[model samples]
Target: MIMCREATKLMSLKLDRPLTRREQLQLRLHTLMCSACRRCESQFELLHGLGDKLPDTDDTSSRS
Candidate 1:
């Protein structure tokens, strides 16, 4: 079983690129068994969607 940390990493990567079949399966299986990871994934997706709707701001302080 994939750990919550690894599953969260996969979820983040999914935002930028499609996961490989194996990666997708791992994340899916992990989320199925781990409620906390599933909630984290849901919150991340919601935050991403909200961010997409906001206009991009030139906040240099936010960038490393």
Candidate 2:
């Protein structure tokens, strides 16, 4: 079973890139058995979704 530390790392990495099948399975299993991690995973997804809807902050071109 993946520990909380590794599980959390995987969770963060998931936001940045696609996880491998093994990593996805491990995180899924960990979240299933750990309620705290499950909640965290939900929160991470929520934040990621919200971030996607936010406007980009790159205004350097506009400044000129």
The best candidate by lDDT is 2
Q: What's the lDDT for candidate 1?
A: 0.93
lDDT of 1 by residue, 1-64 (tens): 8788899999999988999999999999999999999899999999999999999788996899
* TM-score between model 1 and native: 0.86
Model 1 pairs whose backbones collide? none
Go through the candidates in order and give each one's C-alpha lDDT: 0.93, 0.95
lDDT of 2 by residue, 1-64 (tens): 9999999999999999999999999999999899999999889999999999999897887795
